[model samples]
Target: MSSNNAIVLKKYIDPTEGYPKIGEHFGLEERPFNLEATKVDEEHPLLLRNIYTSIDPYIRIRMQNPKYKSYLPSLGINQVIPNLTLAEVVKSAVPEHKTGSHVIFMSGWEEYTLVPKQAMGMVQSVNNPYNLPLMTFVGALGMPSQTAYIGLKHIGQPKAGETIYVSAASGAVGQVVGQLAKAMGLYVVGSAGSDEKIAHLKEIGYDAVFNYKKESVHEALPRVCPKGIDIYFENVGGETLDAVLLNANFHARIIFCGCISQYNNPNPYGLKNYSQILTKSIKVEGFIVMNLMPLYQEEYFREMPKLIAEGKLKYKYDVYMGLGSIPEGFLAVLQGNNFGKALSKIADE
Candidate 1:
């Protein structure tokens, strides 16, 4: 039997509210590995070796009980923490299964997972005909891609020749929105926290990018986006969103993807420019990508990969090695310290 090393939540503590480091709430351990003498049967379980697990700020939202319940299930304390994971099949007991095939499911941050046939619905068979990096499935062509596509094509109802601005533009979701907007014939501008990220955003086709840490968003927007923003892909809310509201064009569209800057703050992230939203006749709408996936799942799967293959899109990742790094890696991404999507590799494929 293969050993299962897992990342277990020690307790359900909001890492953003009081605790600065989330590692204190998580621990790694070797879980039960023993198997039945002859467990194989007509309908059997599938054992998978976890390859890369995505670490994002949204993981912090799951660290709550009923009082702070989200649409997603809460993490169970003293048990394995599960998120979007890419894995390879190592052992299969079912006749229809093929050993060594790759699949993705909402699995744990563990070395191995034994998934029963009843749980097959949660798994998705990955198609790698283009043989792009497997990480692409979890980052670009996955949830982040869907979130960006839906925000622009549907919610924003964007048109060409307009200017769109993205906050936290270097993160997983923001980068895709910027690239897609550029491909859609819009003038795309974005802001990141550092000079290097600003450069990366420009490299990925952002017409202009500013280091928000160096210059205040309110002061920089007018210079970078002289034409006025027609669409605002909101990622960092508090101060940045306030600035966008004041600078946005009349009838501008705002896609409320997330408020990562306010996620860990103990105090409420207040706003001072919401009046601009009304005065400018702006439209602000919030959406959960999960709810929109079914409507455009086929389109996303086809378009995103095609964009990547034709060199129309680019994605980045910050890979961490081994189980021990999970705590810090997860923390790094949540705090906006990572340059790209955070992923932890448990084993080589």
Candidate 2:
């Protein structure tokens, strides 16, 4: 068996420094992926070829140094790029995991991996699993869904009759948040980068939608939420966030799920309207979904799927085929080319 195929990061992408570079591939003997296989190290489980992989904005943050606690830790210099993946278990020494089972975990941008078994979650428990697409486990029903779950609970704390605005409204987290807000009886408004995405938001039940690229957020937001936005589900930051700050009602809640606007920058931008957080009595907080994993396992997983099955919730994904296409797929996402959750299919029926 051969194991030379992998996507390795060549070095840190310091824009002040220069453009990002990709490294060359190495064989299994080189073990450039740093797979550790030792028994009694019960947590790590050897994962088979991934069925699906995710390309989210958060992964871009992990490419930076350990300074931002947004992710577990930055991938090591010269290491395989880490990503969220859905994989079948080829072997497992852990009691909870069985060979041939499908699970979700942190793995490499490759065909196979040895993820710590404890990091894996059994997806079969979600009910009627076969009827649902496997890619959903990594998208609407997976990490992005989890991000929405926590963002709403901790940041938005949405109440009935409140008006909420979601930026980047057609992307993975935005779609989930918009639908969930509508189901919660809130008037949901959204902003998207394209007209097509704005239309999709309306089809999914957003009360109002705007194409941010066509209309300035400063102008479009007030027109949509004239009563003022009580909750802001922020995905793209920078100017959009500034506009939201100006339009926020008193006592607003801002859930900072991501700042996609600043991800590619060599020197990240600072929010100029931050002082509004104090003036509007707004609560602004940022989070990475991993910190909320225990909460999801304890409460969200049990509640969210029922809402989904009942049609009160919805999700979307943009899927690509084959492991080899991942880099291009991910770049498209970084460029906002994907409308929803961006993912790739590495396995077939």
Q: Predicted candidate 2: what Cα RMSD to the true structure?
A: 3.9
Model 1 C-alpha lDDT versus the unseen true structure: 0.83
| Tens digits of lDDT, candidate 2, 197-245 | 9889999999999888888989998899989999999888888898889
Top TM-score prediction, candidate number? 1
Please give each candidate's TM-score. 0.94, 0.86
* Candidate 1 backbone overlaps, count: 0
**Best-performing candidate as measured by lDDT:** 1
Q: Write the per-residue lDDT of candidate 1 for residues 198-278, one digit (tens) a residue.
A: 889989999988999899998999999999999999987888988898889999999999988877777757899889988
Q: After best superposition, candidate 2 residue 219: deviation in angstroms? A: 0.7
Which stretches of candidate 1 lie above 4 Å from their native place? 19-23, 35-44
Give the distance in Å from residue 340's predicted Cα in candidate 2 to where it truly belongs.
1.0
